[model samples]
Structures are given as C-alpha cells and as structure tokens.
Target: MMSNSTGLLLHNAKDDDDEQSPFEEVAANISNKDDPTILCLTFRSVFIGILLTCFDSVVFQFFAYRTSPLDINIGLIILLAYMMGEFMSKVLPEKIFNITINPGAFSIKEHALITIMATSGTTTTFAIKAITVQRIYYNYPVTHVNGILFILVMHLLAFSIAGILKRYLVWPASMIWPKTLMSCCLMRILNIENQTETTETRWTMSRSKFFWLVVLFQFLWYWFPGYIFPLLSMFSFICMIAPHNIVFSQITGANGLGLGVLQFD
Candidate 1:
C-alpha cells in the first residue's frame, strides 16, 4: 500500500511538471506562487515610480536632438528602484500620524509595479512627433491647449486599445515577453535575501558592485568615441585609404553605406 501511494504521488508530480510552460528560463525565474496579503501599491512604490518616470521622460526628451541620444533602459530603472525601495524601507518610520509608511522589507511585487510604471512613462508618444512635424515641416501652428488635448486623446485611445486586447495578449501563459521577462528576473534577484552569499560564481563580486563597475567603465570609455575623438566612433579603413574616392566613401563611409565601418561606440 505504501509503495503504491508513493508511485501515485510521483506520477502526479510528473504531470504537474509537464503542464508547466516549455520555456526553461521562464520556469526557472518566474514563480507561479502569489501572496495576496502582500502590499503592492504602497507610498514608496508610487513615489519612486512617479519620480523615475518624470526623470526618464525629461532626460530622454532633452537628449533626443543630440547626435547620439541617451536612454535610461528598464534594467537600470529596476536597479535604481530596488536601491531606492530598500533605502526607503530602512529610513522611513513604520507609522506616523496613525498611518503606516514603511511596510517591512522591499517586496518583489512593489518593485515590479514601480518598474512597469516607470517603463510606461519612458516611451515617447506619437502625438509629440505629430505636433513637431506639423509645426516644423507643415508650418501649422499647434497651440499649447490643442497640443495637450491631442496628447491626452492619443494616450486614452492607446489605453483603450490595450484594454480590449488584454485578454488575448496579457492573460495567456504562452505570451512571454522577453524584455519583461528580463525585468522580472532582475526583480526576483533583487528581492532574494543573501544573494551574494547564496550565489556561487567565479567573479566573486556582488550584483550592485558589478553594476557600478560596468557603469564606471562605460562612462570613462565613451569619452574616447563620443567627444575626445569622434572619428573613432566609426573607423573605416577603406575611407581612410581612399579619402577622395567617392565610390569608396559611398561604400565604406559611416554616413554612407558603411560596408566595413568598425565602430566602438
């Protein structure tokens, strides 16, 4: 009787495993588990989300006209939000004026919510492009009020469309967004306790330390190609060999066909 029960339990476990999604990364990183008691829409999450959104929108819009534009990707935002969330959890008082402020440790759900909000805000709206084109190319004056209304309407339409499609696109288990999966994995990693000790790697460096190290290296290295020597941005040997040759320039120049351009930036 004992042997039969054990065999039946193993069979059920195998069936459960087979029913899981085929994507190994998704299965490994994402948990099917949920805790309904956990707080998601806390003060920290809202404040951090709005702050990062405004920051990202302003920075990207300001740098859009530059020869090399800069973008703060969701991965960086996840890291920043994680750091800020942790900081707030530790610094903020538990309760003030009969209200709860710090709600225990930073949770993965709160981090994911903040990340989604921040990511949504970073996207450039189509209305901005339309307004710019009308004013610049068509010479059509777009008043401030009209421009604001246009943007608001466009956003509303986009949200409405997304809501209509949510059932087919978002609810399905097969709908695995690779970019969002990456953010999910990052959130899981950040929320894990004693990650530095639990993780075994040859690098021997913590994730935060490694992140800062890479940022520092990129910052110092970009100067060479970005400003110090712009030519280094696109080093075409063929163009150098035949500077006066229009055919060679067209085939290999950075601004042209770029057939054999070697760029570091």
Candidate 2:
C-alpha cells in the first residue's frame, strides 16, 4: 500500500510539472523578487523618472543633428540609474521623524521602474516637432497649457492605437520581440542586488565592475569622434581633396547639403 501511494505521489508531481506552462515555469524560476520592503512606484519615481526622461531626450536630440548620430544606450541609462538609486538609498534620509519624503529604503524595483519610465519618455512625441515648427518656422508660440494638453491628447491617442493593435500584433507567441526579451533579462539582472556566486566561472571581474570598465572605455573613445578627431565622425575624401570647390563641398560635405557621406577614422 505504501509503495502504491509513493508511486501515486510521483505520478501527481509529474502531472503538476506537465500541467505548468513553459512561460509559467520560466516566470516562476527566473523572475526577480526580493525583500518586499521597497516600494516600486511613488511620487519620487515620477519625479526622478521624468527628470531622466528629459535629460536623455535632450542629449539624444543634440546628437541627432551630428553627421554620425550617436545613440544614448538604454542599458547605460539603466546602469547609471542602478548606481544612483543605490547611492541615494544609502545617503538620503529614509524619513524626517514624522514628515517623510522617502518612506523606506530605495529598492531595485524602484530603479528599474524609473529607468523604464525614463525610457518611455525618451521617445519625443510627434506633436513636439509640430509645436516646434509652429514656434520656430511660423513664429506662432503655443502656450505652455496648450503644449501640455497637446502632449496629453497625443499620448491618449497613441495608447488607444496601441491597445487596438495589441491583440493582433502582440498576443502571438511568435510576435514577441527578441530585444524585448533581452531587455527584460537586463532589467532583472540590473535590479538583482544579490547574485548567486558561481565557483565554476573563471572570470574575476564583477558585472558592475565590467560595466564601469566598458563605460570608461566608451567615455574615453567618444572624445575622438566628438572633439579630438573630428575626422573620425566623417572622413569625406571630397572634403579633403576639393576643400575649395563649392560644388564638391556641397556634394560630400557633412556640414553642408551633401550627395553622399563617407566616414572612416
């Protein structure tokens, strides 16, 4: 009877495993969850998130004008947020006696949420250019209130359009974007405060250390293209040879209207 019962228990466990969906299993095993004390979204989240959004938007916009447009990587942003969030949590006062600004210690989830919010806000809306055109080209200034309203209306319309398309575009398993999956993994890794130590791995550097090293390399490298070696951005042969010819300058110059661009460093 005990043998039969053990066999039944094993069968039930197998059944349970079989019943679980692959996605469910993955979510259960791989999802990032830790101490529940840190709140994910708060007024602070909105504040910092919006600020990050604005900063990233401005930086990217400035670079967009360059001959070699540089993308402000979201991963770098996330890393920055992680470091900042961690620092702020340790330094900032949790609460000032009764009156509190920060209710509890900062959490990784908070950092992730802020990063995500800033990322979403980084994409400047189409309405912004429309407003810009009116303000600059036509010299018709849109009032601050009108600008806010325009943004609100545009976002609402976009959200509605997204909802309408989600059923057909997003529901299918095959439609899931690989980059999005990678983003999810990245977020999880970034937010996870404590990682399991592996003895098998021979690499000595921590991920955070590696990230900083890469950042330092990129930071130093950017100066070449951005300032020191301007030719690195666009080494136009025509610009070099026909530096005086207006027609050739127009055809190959990065600053002027050009027929084509050639970039090498």
Candidate 3:
C-alpha cells in the first residue's frame, strides 16, 4: 500500500509540472508580441485629422465647380504627412526641437502639426483644380484676383471649423472611430511583427482579371449607348407618325413641369 501511494504521488506531481510549463510559455509568447503604445495614439490622431480634411473636400463638392482647394485631398495628403512625419522624426537630430526631445518620436502637438501641413498641401491642390475647372469647363467669369480670394477664404473657413470641431467630435471617452481603430490595431500588429523573426506570406489573386472585367463592363455600357442606342432611336422614329395623339401628348406633358392640355374639342 505504501509503495502504491508513493507511485501515485509522483505521477500527480509530473502532471502538475507539465500543466504549469505551457502557461508560462504562453505568457512569454504574449510578452514577446507586445507593441509600443505610441503607435496606436499616433495612428489614431493622424487618421482623424485626415477624416476632417476629407469632410472639408466633401463640403466643396456641394459648392460650384465641385472644387477642392489645391486639388489636395484628405486621403493623399494625410497619408503623405504620416509617412513624412515618421521619416522626418527619424532623420532629424534628437535635440533639434528641444534639448530633451527624442528622435523618431513626437508628442500630440507635433503630430497635429504634421497633419495640418499635409492637409494644407491637399487643400491647396484642390483649390487650384477647382479654379481651373471653373475657368475652363464652367466658364466662370470671375477674374483671377477674385478666384484667388475665394479659394483662400474657403480654405480658411474649412480649416477653422474643422479644427475647432475635431476635438469634440473625435476624442470622446468610449467613442469609437471604427475605421481608425482598425487602422491602429493593424499598425500595432505590423510594429510587433517588425520585432519578430517570422515572415508572413500573403496569398492574393491577380487583380488584372478583375480590372479587365470592370473595363469590359464599362466599355459595353458606353458602347451600347453610343452605337446601339442611336440605331434603336432611329428605328423608333421611322415607325412613328405625328397623329397628334391625345394619349401621347398627355404622356409627354406628364413628364414636363405642367399639367396636360385641357381642350373642349
């Protein structure tokens, strides 16, 4: 009985040790995958900043000429700023900004500055394109000076309104910018992967086929209208006659902005 009891005790101790070993390994693996917190905050700030810029572009769409200032947009400029901020922060001397300032890192203020600069470039481009479109396409009679004034005023308006409102709209506690949050998470994962030895192989289909398919559809839509539609219209006209049909007149007048003809004849 004593020998059996000793054997059972040894077997239970071995199982306990085996169980504890895996938990420790998992904990270490998690620690290895840790990402810098700054990555999340920076990414979110940039994303929201761009979102505001895009909103400005959208507002321009409702105005004459479908113009944005500088032909610059939120998507392109904000992305450029984020990339440049990261690069510049890495390249500039650590003490350039301040004696205590660190290289390759920034406070919220610095990040906002980068975002604003990038947005300025985008807005400027939008304004230029808008003015060109108005001059060339819409035949806007406004002189060069007035156009410049309009562009400047519109830009200032958008920037001031967006800047003032961004804080209240973007940074509420428990508020979720879902797209921005996803972006933040993706950036964090990417950063963590940078420290790992593992290489991830991505699987994707060639987009050429999809691109061609879309091209083919668009070609058909336009081609059918340009060629077949005119032919069909010609055939309909050939089969038609001007009988002064009351029903036809009624239908035609129904499509117009006034009531159908009322005749006592």
My TM-score estimates for the predictions, one after another, are: 0.72, 0.58, 0.33
Per-prediction tally of clashes: 0, 0, 16
lDDT of 2 by residue, 152-262 (tens): 899899999999998677643334455656665566555653344578666766654565587699888888888898877776766778789888888789887755666
Question: Against the unseen true structure, what C-alpha lDDT does each candidate score?
Answer: 0.84, 0.70, 0.48
Q: On residues 40-132, what C-alpha lDDT tens digit does candidate 1 reach at each position?
A: 999899999999989988888788768988878888899899999999999999999988888898888889889988888676888998999
Residues 1-265 of candidate 3 have per-residue lDDT tens digits of 5698899999975654443213342333222232345443444345445665575555544353434333444434444545555665566565744553343564334444445534443333466677788878999867889887988888798879988987677433323455444334323332233332234434232333443466578667765546666442223221234336655544444233223333211
lDDT of 2: 0.70
Best prediction by lDDT: 1
Off by over 4 Å in 2: 1-38, 54-73, 97-100, 103-105, 131-147, 164-175, 178-186, 193-199, 221-265
Candidate 2 C-alpha error for residue 8, in Å: 25
TM-score, ranked from best to worst:
1, 2, 3
What is every candidate's alpha-carbon RMSD to the true fold?
Answer: 6.6, 8.3, 18.0
Q: How many backbone clashes does candidate 3 have?
A: 16
Evaluated at residue 193, the lDDT of candidate 2 is 39
